[model samples]
Target: MMSDDLFETRDSSSREVFTRYNREDRIKKASEKVRQLHDPDFIRKRSFIKSVTENRGLRSVFFVIVVLVSINIAFFVTRSDKNNGRIYGIKTELKSFIYQDRALANLRLSENTKFLESLKESEEKDGALVRVNFIFLDDKGTKLSSSLQTGIYMGTELRFSSQDESGNAKKVQAEIYIKEKLLVLSSKIK
Candidate 1:
């Protein structure tokens, strides 16, 4: 009897216990329970938590996208300009930097030029002495009589206004400027 009772199969009589589950009955019961709750804040919090838990991958994807975009922005952004921070095209940025460097170089060159000019001017003001010799040459390039002239060294030039041995006012001639080791002379008699 005991062996037979243990081996025999019996059909369940309870409908709830025997049948497969469906969501319709569960949904209706859950909705009725939710309606009994009167607090909107509580419901909102619970729904938000449930939604976040269910769609977890969406949040991760959104976070990854945000991080990538921020990194991209960082790579292109720069504060090299001496002004308010703002984005500019790569070509425009390069041009501005190049122009700024050129301007600075030009400024330094101008300053150096001014300093040299001032030093030269000081030498001239101090009446720096210079020795000059005038050699008279004939048309055949033959050496003639030589004479000495009175002149002053004006930094790079030797200038004087003096007459010839005959003391003629019109014969006054001065040779000036031997810049960069070059000398040119042209005379016209009217």
Candidate 2:
């Protein structure tokens, strides 16, 4: 024999016992609601937008790819290989020499065509001096004579006519050292 008050259910307990909707049913309902609010074409068009918004890793990868592509394009557009392709200096044919009283060595220095073209292209940008140094070496690689010349542009001829008291003419090799700004070029003439 239980008491009626003990057997009676309370209103708070009845209220606390709530019903839960099914997962599939809730998803269907939400989809229907979305379809009613937005056009089908618009939803289809924006499906990728939802995916990109939900997938953080995918979005990061896409952002990185875009940045890399942009960087590559910028590098290709702004890069120039003109300086690397330039020629620094060249040794020209030796001119005639007069060796009456002594041994005379006549030499010519010429600017490389490619170097001149590059210089012309950047003439408006900056100015630099090109120093040409001529060295005469005998068969034994001994230094016979040397001369230095400086110019902003163009080529020049070097004439060495002063002969020692011996007045003996000797076959020697000529070397030209060209210094342009920070570039150095050396060449031997036969």
Candidate 3:
């Protein structure tokens, strides 16, 4: 009779065991749904981090691009500053030459002062030839206060000038032809 009672208890506990298993399964499914909803972007962020960490070549490419861009900016800034510094030297030399030529022109009055003729009339052996035309007008067509025409030849030996204000060249322009081609165009500023 005890064996029959044991069989009855075992049959009853089976139902309770099933109920506990169902409760645990429900709790696990609910936790999984909550995780998916709360951390929707977790998968994408993990994939991105893994890809960057594993690919050495991609990381190196990014580093090289940054280094090259920085170097390019530094080189450009230094080169531009150097070019600006050279302009001051050119301006000072040009001003001194103009002042010296003006003072000397006051002494020579007998020479026929026409204008700077073509380079064909003169020869440039040293290759440094500057033909200056006494510009009488500005960019707005305003006349300058002084008028003088001189050409810097080779190393400052040959110069041409006009006889007087009336005989001076008009619309003065200096053309620096290199190898017989027009390379630079300069005008005298009074």
Poorly placed runs, candidate 1 (over 4 Å)? 1-117, 120-125, 153-190
Best by TM-score: 2
Please, what is the whole-model Cα lDDT of each candidate in the order they appear?
Answer: 0.32, 0.46, 0.37
**Residue 187 C-alpha lDDT in model 3:** 35
Task: Assess candidate 3 and give its TM-score to the true structure.
Answer: 0.23
What is candidate 1's lDDT per residue for 95-118, written digit by digit as tens?
Answer: 111222121000000012333355
Q: Model 3 — which ten-residue stretch has the worst lDDT?
A: 83-92
Q: Candidate 2, which ten residues in sequence have the lowest lDDT sum?
A: 79-88
Ranking by TM-score: 2, 3, 1
All candidates: CA RMSD in angstroms? 25.7, 17.0, 17.8
Candidate 2 per-residue lDDT over residues 143-190, each given as its tens digit: 666556555544333322222223333433333333433332222322
How many residue pairs clash in all the candidates, one count each? 0, 0, 3
Clashing pairs in 1: none
> Could you tell me the C-alpha RMSD of candidate 3 in Å?
17.8
For model 1 the local lDDT of residue 13 reads 72
lDDT, candidate 1, residue 149? 43
Q: How do the candidates rank by lDDT, highest first? A: 2, 3, 1
Please estimate how well model 3 matches the true structure, expressed as its whole-model Cα lDDT: 0.37
Which candidate should be chosen as best, given lDDT against the real structure? 2
